[model samples]
Target: MRRFRARRRQEPTNQMRYSSATDVPQVVPPPIEAAAGRVTESERRTSSQRFRGDIQGLRAVAVLAVLGFHTGMPLLSGGFVGVDVFFVISGFLITGLIDREIGRTGRLRLSRFWARRVRRLLPATAVVLVTVGAMTLLVLPMTRWSSVAWDIATSALYVVNWRLADQSVSYLASDDAPSPVQHYWSLAVEEQFYIVWPLMILLVLWLQRRYRLPLTRAMLTGIAAIGVPSFIWSIVLTKTSPGPAYFVSTTRLWELAIGGALAILAHRIPRLPAVWAHLLGVAGLTAIVLAVVTFDAATPFPGIAALVPTLGAAAVIAAGTVGRRTISDLVLDTPIMRDIGTLSYSLYLWHWPLLIGAAAMWGEDNELPVTIAVTVVGFSVVPAWLTHRLVEAPIHRAKVFVRLPGWAAVLGVVCTAIGVATAVIVSLAVPKQPSYAVGGEAPGAAVLDAIPAQDPDGRPADSVDLLVPDVLAAREDLATLGGEPCISELEGTELEACSYGPEDADVTMALVGDSKAHQWLPAFQRIADERGWRILTYLKSACPLARVDIKYEDRANQDCAEYNETRYDRLHELESIDYVVTSQVASQAYLGPNESQREQTDAMVEDLRRTWTGLEDAGRQVIVLVDNPNPEHEVIECVAEHGDELSACAFPRAIGAERGGAPAQLAALEGLDGVSSVDVNDYICPGDMCPAVIGNVLIYRRGSHLTATYVDSLTPRLDEALIAAMR
Candidate 1:
């Protein structure tokens, strides 16, 4: 007689077990095994080992959410949570496989297990990396290319998480736009987890065997011990140092443990009622969708906030019944959902780069077409399906490779090493050309070809060659470019507080503004010392000297606005400050369709007028320094492009001077009774062509900003301009 019965197992969405006698306690004790020993064929048939369609559908939802978000679609703003979904899914699947293998076999074959993993992960990853490298070279600018190359090398090594952490402190890293491979940070995290988790499971299993503890009890104990602390550390670290905490591997272990815990209980839960199973699955899927919609970058990550999706994934995975239900059967167990689930892994890998590449090509300012993002998805899916069939399936079916674990290990290491080396070489060897080069090959081809070739001269070039010097000389020319030493020998031990000035100083000159103002310091200090004038500084990073309508990069620059407003107020109250010097970043920080030159000029003039009016009212003098000419590229690059032949490379004299674009607004300022604009363009430029270097100092520090050293060298020229403006 054949007996038919349904058996169910309850597995957590995230967890793993080790293959050893100690890893898991025997489900049945030896003494009781004899009573139930005559296990009939009918009993084996009752065991539950069936695929859950709802869980697959959930995978589809998670992947699609992430894809939508990356595509820059407004609908999936919180789609980044797809990673959380993936983590849970990975945990559940890996743990279940480990547990099942360990329970059935006496020992875990490390080689066989790794081979299986390699087959699953390697081929698709290779396809993506190679494609990304090609696209990066094709689209990114020269300024952006080197960094992109470095990031690609790091990504290939699966260490991009560490790289991102190092760059976290830089303002550039947090800029609104990010690179294509930035999404690889998650892959790095997962790969790092894989390194320690398997060994940890083995150790736990061994201890259980030696101690004669129940497998369930040992697993639970280990999970609690590891998971609780990891969770706490994640919370503490995320709060204390968010970027590092988010990227580090130590903080992510618990998410995997959540799945491992699921593996521990996979054999226990009985079949749920069809109605209840469907409700649970549907509820879990809905929760995941809701979580995606709510989470964003500003939200603290990998903490308790992550639990929402983690638990939701577990709910869907554990809900085994796939029978037609009121909700789950209708929505979660559909054919369309299953197709997405099957393609989810490859889709996740391919979509981010597509979106990033699209955004880069389209320019962040332009609204990317919905069809473009959709097209990327469509293109990605075809390769993903082919890879799954041609690469993944073949590797899985070939048992001969799995039998030779050592060979598999060697192959895996060799392939990975070769790929990484190729990426490194490609990065170092590839030269960046202008975007236009790809459009056509002409003399520009020579320009493109010359891109990677280093200049024969050893010295670094200035960022901007905006000097119109009659004669150009090598950087060695300006020994006395920086001003003479001016010191104030104070009694205090504090080094920074000790003031500096001329031996017999009478006039007081104050410099204040953002980094732009600071750039002028070396020049101002030099002139002040030579003229027996005391120089006081009230400068800050990126904080321009302005009062009303203060904002930068489209956001309210509260700190800068407050700092400048307060400093101006304090300066006006001072009895001293015979001459005040300041500069600003005008077009660099603000310029667009919405922000016209007219509007910016008017606001800037008004702010200057207010400051001048107040200072003059208090019997003081104020000098308004015009905006420095920003360069399109770094000056050194210009010098290098000119083969370090300074005379051959010329800077435009018209770059920084007042122009028709803003002169009417400046005339409004000139209308003020006591205010005047000091133009430094003449002294700095001197002619139609400007030299990047004068007196041996590098002209531009970056693309347009003046370097501190070069600014120091400009003291003599700047002093002459200031004297005229002050008089």
Candidate 2:
């Protein structure tokens, strides 16, 4: 025991200094018997070294899977598993390198390792980022520029994964176009792994030496105990909040550990007959292929489901190149696979930007032909090879690579400056958005005028709930406007609800509907104040005021239907309401049983017509404001996402019975006696495409939803329509 302890102590040389791989000393094994005496069965088994082409082949597989998936190739639907494969490969390679280094020298060179990795990664990254930055400025709309710039900066720093997670771009939300850098999330994961993994290995190695512990035994024990719990956490977290699972590095650490475990056990696989080796390799390859074929977005990620590909990779790696040859070996070692493997990093970096840039320049609807894809392929190869040859290999080979303090600082500063410059350029090029445009008027003053104003003594509305308080900065400018917040949080649900004015204001007018009518509120408020109308608002986000019950995404929204019904009942009980005003888009989806699209729409129209007719029969005047034409951009996204395409953001003025037709829906009200339809199409859409911004206010706050400013601006028009309808 004492002799064994002394030998273990002698293994880690204090003289071994922290340095680059180039400076790493050669390792020689002790005599087999003596080494065995010093090491345990588990330790020897755990620390074996075996070369596996399957892993490299696996790399080829992963990259191909990802590339095919991104290319929208029909055969590669499950190509997303490529990232999982990469995770396993990363773990294997990193662990192999660390374990081998520790076995040879007893200490790990943390800085030099990181520097080589940075050089390997950063050069091509810088090139792609600069290229994408230039292209974003050249073709992207001004409104999108800011976000693109911010994303570029984050990607450059390897922190883009966190930012994207925070943005909550649902993994399933299949927007036609995605950002070019969206693929960087995986790169970020890899980079983060590189940052901490070497240190972890070093700590483990030091602990092994200090305690006279066998290295392999320590690693295996640590991995099993730590890795299993991590895997469980990953599953739980992924199921609970996929957003966090996607973004958080901690959840993914175990995937790499799987590869690390394989590295620790590489040499122990019983030497199999050539036929068995070939069979195992073939089986492993088939498993991977099947996984790639069947997996999809709905599949739970990085969980136990990930093990199929991971274990398959491990099996292939275990079936080494020597002694047994499989058809997979021939395929993987083929020149094409090898070349793609060589260029994988570069290909990954370039493909997304090329695709996205192409999408931005042309629309996403167009396909990138073989020529364009090949052009992207060409661009990827040249730069990647050059970066590997020039920056990565040479820097890694240099002795200075190990001893550089100022270099890291200098590199960081340069990266920061580039990021800042890119940001400023993007910001300067993007147009500034003017305030107030929510539904389709000028942002500031023009929107205000566009709002409908009520005549004095019109007590049709009351004060608003949660009106912008004078104390809050956002509310300061709007304080004089004097309407309730277009959105009020309901009690238990804490969801935003829209109500007209104070419930008891002598005269009552209900501002009821989806976000579109919400946009028309400023105009309604003006009319209410002048007419002394008590405003009663009943509204929900994305839930239109149509009485037709509806389903959302196949789920019944009984709460929404109930909410509307209750609000209507409250309005019926109101004592002072002399007039009823309901405004909403006609094409809104409703939720309920027996609520086919047509039925829901017809039911909504009938409900509104019935309410108006009932009010008229009760001797109360009834006026209906025709819903505004919907813009392609949501009322808010027009402000937030598409502010650059100001014209594209606006509501179309053309009146028609086509889809999203408010005029047609309102026209149905014509036959209802004592109910009048007030058309605001002229005020909203003035041309072919509905403009998101008229004078300058963002017409919609998001997509087709109107901003409070634009909603506030509709006072005059709403008032005019009411007066005309009442007359």
Candidate 3:
């Protein structure tokens, strides 16, 4: 009786008897009878299911791997595969429960099932969201608050996955720091599956009953219908757009479907011999461990690579279902494992925000202490245990939900909705102080005239009001070409030449290179307007005008190289072009392999020399505006956090000018005809230090690019340099 048995009854529920006085003979069809018998058996087996310790243990392993990966353990770099394991387990358990429900009753209780899910998940989730919202405001910079608030709101509504997918693709948002609530994206994916899967099952069950199809066969067909296409799409999108593919529900559905398939066919699967079961379980465990160690950030993920761990998890589950005790079952069935498994959901929810909050409080450069990390993880258990005991346990134990009046249930739902809406409103309503004055005298003219005497170490005595109501918005204003169609973006259409300045100006000057070159456009545009000169701009994001090939995110930038070549050829053909101005992030240059910093710098200088010499040879005057000091962190973010005392955010001139300065430019322009190099390093860095604010203006918008407001202040200085270089 304790032995595992299939859920089939030996006898049919209803029997047909032959009548003694029969005008017509009564016949029993064997096929119809057998089908009826099978359905009855399935129903019986479904009602007598036992708890699976192996599944609970599997949950423990999955959560541990995820926790390790998130804690930045180098050995568990690929532990993200744990999510795949979780998906499979979820699929198996949820499908099993639903199948049993359908077997016992003719219809699925959609409302009751969903209510259980909401009660189990939402209460704890809302608490985490609220806690994260408060922490984000207190610990993180105001610059991040707006985004974090929206993320929290979306996480509460269980749609953060789509938001994350959108953000992953946005170039502007690419450099944004991770949110405290970012882990909720995974929960969002699972919640979405919960919403759609039951309806799908309902449809399948209805079809099976109406069409006289076998229940198991019908369910398998439905699962395959969704799973197969999803798997194929996952492969396609992972190759083409890995960022979005990684987080989206569609790409991840097949992983869950694998578990569902196993659950549906559990009865049909043959039991393995003891030796084979042990071997399979061990192999499954090995595969999971191997994936965690071997896979890294560079690995093309969740594509063919994902099959390793998913199949491994599937194998372990399958092994546990049959034969003698498997290695996985033995290892995973311990009391501690079961307890951790019970607390897995809450642990998953609590750990991420704590880790992210730690990083935000202490900058990323300073790793959280191992002891502190352990302590924090330990502390997370307090909340996890409390949440499980106080919220989750009570909800599951109370069958009163089923007996509650419909109006009472409706009121509970309404109240929950109101609570979530209120949290969102409160998060969004947090006020930010305005820092920068808008509509002042021309920032460039004012700063240039007012810059105080340099300190003994060469730092400027004057501090600028870089802090604004919105620093990012002000930084966006720095680029006159923010939305210009001609500025090529990644995957943009064919490049077109763009022109600015006076339409009928006699003299033509060209500004060309990456975004760094584009940043100088506002200053040059002002010069052009003042002097009746035509300005032609050829700029692209992350693409330098240098002759050397560039690499981004470990891939060769073929588009950048091609654009540079084509643009160079076009520049040669432009007869009216007199002056060619160029600048770029000098440190980004890729010299061959194993090159030291000096060697790379030298190689970059040589590339610049070749490009500038070509321009001069073509009867064009070359003016190289030396790239600005590169700050190691976002200047605006620092200014936002430390606006009252901007010096706290200042970096030494030695570090700021490490990449770009007079040395590199002079080396490139040496002995070159019709070419000149100009640098305002003295003004930019002041002396020993480069402060975030200079002369009441924010110096840099992001890290290196001068804020348009700051650049406006530098026009008088820049004009003198440009006029001298041209002469």
Which candidate tops lDDT?
A: 3
Point out where model 3 deviates above 4 Å.
Answer: 1-48, 206-214, 364-375, 405-429, 436-446, 449-478, 482-498, 501-514, 531-582, 586-625, 659-678
The lDDT values for all models are: 0.56, 0.55, 0.67
| Candidate 2 residue-wise lDDT, 1-727, digit = tens | 0000000010110000011222212111111222325434454343343334444555777777776655555556556677777777677666666665555445566765666566556655666777778878776544456677777778777777777555532211212134556677777777887877766666665676689786678777666665687788889865654545656677777877887787676545544567766777778788789887876544556567778877777667656533345667887756677556656766677766776666445432334554455456456666667765665457545566457744754664575567657767776765453332224323332333434422222111121112111111121222112445454221111334344456667766666665445556667667766766666566554455445554442333444566667666655666566766666554544544335767666665666666566657765666666665554433333333433444433343453224453643575576776777777554455445554444444344433344456455555665666677774
Candidate 3 lowest-lDDT run of ten: 11-20
TM-score of each: 0.66, 0.67, 0.82
RMSD (CA, Å), each prediction: 12.1, 12.3, 10.9
Kindly report which residue stretches of model 1 are placed more than 4 angstroms away from their true locations once superposed. Answer: 1-48, 172-177, 268-279, 321-326, 364-367, 430-727
Maximum-TM-score candidate: 3
lDDT of 1 by residue, 1-727 (tens): 1111000000011111111111112221111111223333333223323445655666777777777665556646566677777776666566655655565454456667776666566556666777777777676433344566677677767787777665553332322235566767767777776666667667777897798766667767877687778889989876655556666666777877786676566444334566666667667777787877776554566687878777777677656433234365466568998777767766666766666667556632223566676677678887778866676556655676767666666656765765576577656654443211122211211221233323323222333233221112222112121342221111111112113575346888776554455556666656766777887776554455566544442334444555656677767776767777666554222333267766766666666667668777877777767656654333544454453476554545465344212242254467775766666654344445555664444465443455555555456557767878776
Residue range with the least summed lDDT across 10 consecutive positions in model 1: 4-13
Backbone clash count for every predicted candidate, in the order shown? 27, 99, 10
lDDT winner between candidates 2 and 3: 3
